[model samples]
Target: MSTQQEQLDFIERHLVYDIFKDFGPEASLEFHKVECSNGLDGFMSALYTVTLELVIRERKRTEVVLVKFMKGTEEFRESSNSYIQFANEIFAYAEILPAYENVLRTSHLESEVVSNWVPRCYFARFGQVEGLSNGRESVLALKHLKNDGYQLGPRLILRRDHLEAMVGLIGPFHALGYATRILQPQVHARLRAGVVDMPFVSESGKAIFDVLYRVAFDRFYEFYDRQKEQLLKDTDPGFGAAIERLREKYFKQPTQLLEWIRTNSYAADQADSHFATFLHGDYNRNNVLFHYGADDKVDGIKAIDFQELRFSTTAIDLSFFLYMNTASEGREEIYAELLRKYHSHMIQMLELVLRRNQDELTDDRGAELLKEYSFERFNGHFKRYAFYGALVCMHFLPWLLGNEKDCAELSRLFDTDMHGPAFHQLSMDIAGDEANEEIFKIVRHAYEHGYMDEI
Candidate 1:
């Protein structure tokens, strides 16, 4: 059968037949692709936007759903561990999202309604499908959000307004996870059961990180050499020593540095476990869509791509956005203000969950809860976040700022040494392409604040 035929049969078996039987006995269904693209992120999945046309009772109607299918190549499977990514994404749609909504509904708060903050899934299935020789097909079909007036954020540079809108949306997303944990512990456990630990901690992920870490060390040293005379003149004699220490961390103990990052990245109330949440792990500009209003200003945001979701502290999600999305000048000016805004919304989301359980938060009660999962205390690991930002610039910035041709080269990433001249130049080019200053400022700020003392 043709690919289209296979897809039609798949949809009918999974979705249309059940609904159409009620619409009319003589109903018929057909679907055609409206848009198709290889995923920009390179590893998790490829996308196809299709419109399903249904005719029944002498009338016709249409529904559009975006289908995400796991990349079927062995290269992707081996390099990124596609199975784990697919499992997390499928579990996110099938289990986590529903549990989050249930928590909201039970809370009886203003935010109780299932909002458009995340796309609605029409159908999600994983495991065997008849057609493919591998017999494995993992797919998620969600409502076409663009049809509802959402637009992708700019790829190269994000505006201050756009960054604020993302923080506004993601803050509640993280809070909802926390509220679910407090109010619906059983459901929270179920959600956690579906997610694996952070992938970078895995052996394969660490191998990749090792390469990028070296490149980042070199990138920093190259910057220092370029500014050595000026830096020494402006600061204490130990300025060069500090940079040398950073270089040594990446060169001699890259794995230990990663461990340091992971260890301090989360906090625990007692022993063994940290305050955890379902994270939108790849929370960058491309993964977020904005809904615009009368003046073409952003009114709201909808986050996409949950393949990287993991159970982690709020700081992981919060810091990823701050580091990846905001510019240096703007980030320093609004850093504390933006964090406060996110923390405030997090509290509001938790309040709604509290209301659902007939537990109102008095000032003392709120203070105690805050102390238990203190935003300020948790975020005190700003150096870890800054470290993560620098590392991403070593690798991700190239792809983020690359053209289609550049992204194609990324598909062969593991075959090449990331610290080699070709890859190093690519990183430098992307950094010089208006991306380096922000990361430098973030790292320097961390040093100035003594946030790196723990490491």
Candidate 2:
């Protein structure tokens, strides 16, 4: 293991020099001081908060940046089917977001604008570090949003306004994808081509998924059994059977829909035109940071962590946010309202793109175009992946809701093997948390919406 000083030395010599060279000659940028501190711990990367005192072009300034490094253990990095994750993150920061913004900037959309919903990326490199070889030393430097008054939401339960704030951000994000598909077909195609094939579709990922599914399903069923009385009483009579059927058909098999998504993930025929945009595959409460306004209410939200970006429907992002963060009470109360707002923003953004494209609204062609990009079509695709929403909740809620100690233990346990008994125990512990009712609400919603039958 490298000493702390050694790591600091590496940052100063390599990272700092790279940033300085971007502006002008190295001498033009004088570095005076540097300090580094631990950042938020992620599952697959180590983050550092690097502060720098510098003079550039006679202007003295202090800069703080968050550096993400693929510094996981060799065993975990190699074993977890992480080959494409780093590349996916780098692609999102370096290419995808910029392309989306460029589409907006170049368009004649008088009413709409592209907001910076994610942190500004300063630099991204793969296979740069000398000793951290085999693509393990990938690094990303991003503006530290926390320095600008952004903070994480309470992980236990997200409030209604917080959920709305996130919805507001994601709505435009998905709309960009829809707009790009219509306005700049070539750009959209290029982005679609670049979506990293989810590791779970591969042979090794298949093995991992097998183990992961078994343990995840076991925990899920255990949670169901524990709450059988209340859930059956409060939910539809079909709840218990639907859960069991999904376990057997989807989780046990694991590929029924996996193959479908893989085969059709990128196909863009009008018949099944659901795969429209680059989705933040890991949209959750922890991945979003909130900016509080003067009233102490959340006024803005920014997303972080792009390792799970996928060329999929907006529903994937929407369902993940809704099920993962919002409590049952909040979801039940505001689910329709949230969807309506998200759909409205998406339509507004799409209209801007349509206007820029100069597509005639009175003609049959324009009507077809609007229908193709309609919210009803998007809802159809979202419901199709409702099974995935529930599955992700079962696999993720444990870690998200666990206490610090439990989270640490759970992370350490699952980092190596997915099917270990200890993993199931920890997952069960997570499902047993009272917060699980929130997730159950998601599952219940899915069933009520006929997602259970469709899956």
Candidate 3:
């Protein structure tokens, strides 16, 4: 009966020895294990290992490969299976680059032509072959990244040049969605089904969403107060009044708000649109990885985290990306430019998808549906829902702001510091100037756009 840590150590050694057996005793191996701490559930820990060896047959060849392992309890084994199945499905459709190959290749090719965006696929599998019963299991794999990098949550915030180069990468992702719709209508439909209505449909899941939404809104109000005062002093009476009205309409009417959410929760299958295609659900700076050149110019951009991929108005993803990533100071100035770039890429993709599936898309009805479901209008139409989005954003903002130490301070105000200082620290970190400004901007935007009135 070895302890979990001891078992982990033994497993690592065994894996290294088994995989690099040809390297003989001279082969070197290193292991690093990081506990999942960002409120992530259902896992023991994530481990990274590096093995170095020289090929005995090819004496001149030396190689170093990295392996990732997901270790978890028996309970997690079931959930891990679901996750593995999902990952396998994604991999089956697209080659697994260390990051996103299609996005990187599309961007690279647009700037400088490339033959193909597909990557060389390696093996992928769950940790347990027999599956966990009562103990823990370790799943592992190896891969090579052409570029050394780390992920910022779901997004890849790599070197600066990588960020800029990503603009081109977006083109190809948009292209692929369009191409899929045209060339493989049934496949596209199936992918859409997989994305929008995947398993997570339990009543408990809905309750969790409700709780998250409430937490998000409460946090938004706390931040919104600062902006209300500022706008009042600045003589923006209309904006101030709108905020008050919105508070009355939505925040004060929690029951009504929940009812509205429940009513609108179902996916809408409105009039057809030609522009519809697979949308990157969580497109943002965080989800994108950039390869940089000298002076921080982006040489390449790779979009990752396709777990939320689904069929929707392209505007949903594009708007979210711009709103979340762009700075507040320059947002208004760059809004049109961003929209232009997004739409241009989207239009090109739509055309390509149509061209490939001329017979399937011959109806032109889909295009009309898309035109009617314009992102700008959708944003305005769903501004109340922005509260929901903003709430989700708040959950991650503390990490983004690099504040996890002030949780205790926040807990003091709440009367019980069950989570101790860490919770307060996170709250304090996220309650910074930038976050406040962003929250206020959203509040003000919602007010001015008449979202408050209808809510």
Candidate 4:
């Protein structure tokens, strides 16, 4: 373990010094190591450094900044680098900033255009370090919104207002991608190549997917086996049929399903004639921070976690937010309205991108792209991919819900000898009636859309 003095020494060498020079000889810093009993895979610690200043300076003020440090195991560190490389590839066409100026300017311009919908980026940087065998680190310094707070993670239920705010932000974020396509066509093309035709098909991603699918299948069977009686007694006949049909199709023929996935994994690799633009791959509520007033209505929203940014269909982002955020009981009622809102915002932004960069993309081509890649068409893909999404939800829900007990059983079923089964089990335990209903709704939506047709 790194001692307090050792940590302080590391900080003295790394942190900007002019900000800390004012502290008297007796002034000391405080360190707090946050325990993520919640079972997340990362090392997070918050440092609160307080210093007293002399009277000589024109500004005699105390300085306090919260530094959140995240570190990973050797394997995880390597994986994080690969992830950063992927992000860098997406931004290759655009200028990436070590300072906040460029990102701030871009964000301000976007906010003005979109009005009520933009996230603020404070600072971002990538550099090498001496610790852990001189590995590189990517650090993002963000404005700490003490007043604004975040809701529960994606697994939890989302309020109507929360849903509305999130949907509103999607329009402008997607528009930014479209704008990039027009203003920087060549860059956009590069991003398209890098994002859609991801090396996942060829790289370690193939092995990762192979393992993930097998684990997913095994878990599905365990869940099915354990809940067989309950499934038979399910009140909704349609729901029972859907589950059984899925089991008969996928459970008995796991290899066939895996083969099918392997075949279609490259389906979106080729950028179709449809519109392609920048996409926030994991645009869930968890990544969206909400600013709420006394009334609990959303005043502002900012997005975090750019780890999954890529170039692809706008619908991919929209569907992720919708499926992950919305609950079961009210989803059908709000789905149409939310979809309409997303479309309207997207078209408006698309128009802006075209108008600003007339030479790059003609109005006709832009409109054609927009129409071809409309949300309606994309929803079809969402329905088809809903099973995969559900599988992901099932696997992680226990951890998210803070159910640690059943995590071991869940892990064993997945054929992974890793720890943290308890955390996943805790998550499953915490998922209340509302979450169950939400899961059912998603499954029903898939069924109604004929997602199980082939089965």
Candidate 5:
């Protein structure tokens, strides 16, 4: 919608004031432009790399920064709490992550220290313009990881090694979140008030699904029609009856579907809050970035997109990674191994974090907290919370596996009429033999494995 200039203008006005205090006076803008970050990277917002060639101290230097700007149709933004969502992310980087770092640093640990698990956010503000209604004034500027060789792994199904790296990292980091709550309750409460649960369970969060549920399924119907005629018709018969059954059971009637979605999304806010840990909230593949080391192996990883970061149970985060990011093949084959590996990491990290608080939190209290989230309890929690994985995968994989071009086009449609003829065309374009086959496999696996039944 030609809003890049507006975003850049906002950054230009606030750059020196917010970030560059002493050096800004000598620095002059030399060059700047928008770099494309496709829809898969950010569906709810616009992503761009802004390079400012500045003349500082009579020398020319270039600084490349990543930017996330609010994007989506006007109606979608309002319905989904897009403005507030952006504010939530800004809170994560500006307030939450730093407080976490401070907590770990101040802990009386005699062991290693863990860094906060995100890229540095240089500047963040939500809707600071005159009206604040239009989200043009919203932007989050961060240190660009891509410039330093961090890259996104495969889009569709992640390899086993990548999955291992992700679990290994977040497991311990989650412990740190709870550690903060135990060590610094006042700080923890302040941060929680600032962060909002996202995408699925605010007052208006579930309401957006009313419009989106039908739109996505209607697109699926068009995709199914094309597949049946072009491919499945001769290969497999009676597919239509199965599709009709699914539509009647889940698609046509969404009362249970919505309920299942809400309960699993955050687990009805839980009974005892001890079961809750800090969550990456939406820990899908798009939100994770990987770094390959000398042997071409994944040596390190960093997280992106804190828009959905909140405090919740680890069940949904684990389920989202397993279900939404991994391919059906990966999900089926390494699912148990992944779970065990993550539980192991959580155990190790929980011990490490609790030990730091032993003087204040006490051994008896620490033992109780550990008992609350034992591996046995974790397995059962996954059963109930895994439904979140099934729901979001349907939306993520269809767009990601088909084509980046389609996703980019679909992302642009966020600022357009999503139910119009153009959206239908894009939806059709997003369906492919591989994409359709992969997504249906996920749905089939969900049904067969009783993930749907558990909900």
Candidate 6:
């Protein structure tokens, strides 16, 4: 094993200098300070921040970059089918992102680069693309967002401004794929064919989800048992049984729907092709970071953890983000506006990108994309597909919303392949916390909307 100092030295020389030399001809790296980092809900990667002190043209400056080494052990990687995840992430950062930015650069309308929405990946390597990796020694480096004043919001906190900022970006994130299809069909085709959403599609993938699902159910039951007495005290004599029956019926629907999705994920329904786009797939407070201005308002955001990224209907990204971060009430209020924002922006991007290539798409033909892609068509798919958002929340929220200790404990257990009674107890504490009211809100929204019935 490489010692920590040796690794830092390698990173500073091989990684940091390569990324920073572009700062200027006179730019020279003094050194880099490496610090480890992990979020409460972060369980997938070994992360670190490398701050480099550089002198550029006689001026001293400090630049911070992030480095992510693959974290899944051989067995864990095999069981999770993370090979596909790693491949997709590396493909996105290395291949897809640059092409997307190129489309914008050649467009008629002014556009921000992909790095504005996602971090600027300085370097990335994974199996099958840049060479080979055995789920180890895979490395990705990127400009650290914290260096740009971005911070992760609380796991359960849902501020409207933050949601709006994120919703605005989701449009362009997916829009780039649409634009690429129109502007660079060959490149788009290459990417669509290359990336695979295999995390939950294979038998091993299904097994890992089953383990997580089992833990969610067990913890909820434990919490329910612990709270049943007081829960009944404030209710009618027969209310306890009524709730127990409802609860049993309630959770099962998502389990069924989630299993259904595992079978039908990334389904390219012809009727919904116009609305099909890339999905961030995983979007929680952990995966998205926000930058606030001096007025304490969110003006910008960045998305990370493209491990679950895939090409799918836009609803998957939209609903997953809103439901994961916003409670039912908050989501319902802004949901329509968010849908409008994403659709409009996506269409706008498509129009602007095709403006110069009238032979490919004319003003009349460009406008037809909007005519063909209607809000009603898009919203209908969202209603049918919104359950995906709820189900992901169900499987993950129990552990993600837990306290710091719970996250650390869960990570250790997950890494060691030891999901035992001890794991159950930690999950019970997480699921049982009285503050976990939002999970019920997610369930109620799905139940009220008949998401379960659709399955």
Candidate number with greatest lDDT: 2
Off by over 4 Å in 1: 1-35, 39-44, 55-60, 129-136, 201-207, 230-240, 253-255, 263-274, 359-367, 381-386, 402-408, 411-425, 428-434
Which 10 residues in a row give candidate 3 its minimum summed lDDT? 34-43
Tell me how far candidate 1 lies from the true structure as C-alpha RMSD in angstroms.
Answer: 4.2
Candidates sorted on lDDT, descending: 2, 6, 5, 1, 4, 3
What would the TM-score be for candidate 1 when compared with the true structure? 0.83
Top candidate (TM-score): 2
lDDT of 2 by residue, 361-396 (tens): 445655677777677776776666656676677667
lDDT of 3 by residue, 143-235 (tens): 333434423323312232332344445554655665555555575665655552333223433222333334455666676664556546764
**Is candidate 1 or 4 superior in TM-score?**
1
**Candidate scoring better on lDDT of 2 and 3:** 2
| Segments in model 3 whose C-alpha atoms lie over 4 Å from true places | 1-45, 52-121, 126-167, 196-212, 235-238, 241-269, 272-279, 307-316, 356-391, 404-434, 445-455
Better of 2 and 3 by TM-score: 2
Alpha carbon lDDT of each predicted model: 0.63, 0.69, 0.45, 0.49, 0.67, 0.68
Candidate 5: stretches off by over 4 Å: 1-3, 22-43, 46-48, 52-62, 72-76, 108-116, 127-136, 197-208, 215-273, 421-429, 447-449
lDDT of 6 by residue, 207-261 (tens): 4665666666555555557766754464444445544654566454324545455
lDDT string, candidate 4, 260-311, tens digits: 4323423566434234455565677766778777897877776655555654
TM-score of each: 0.83, 0.87, 0.63, 0.67, 0.79, 0.84
lDDT over C-alpha atoms for residue 209 of model 3: 32
lDDT of 3: 0.45
Quick one: ranking by TM-score, best first?
A: 2, 6, 1, 5, 4, 3
lDDT, model 5: 0.67
List, in order, the clash count of every candidate structure.
Answer: 1, 0, 31, 13, 1, 0
Candidate with better lDDT, 3 vs 6: 6
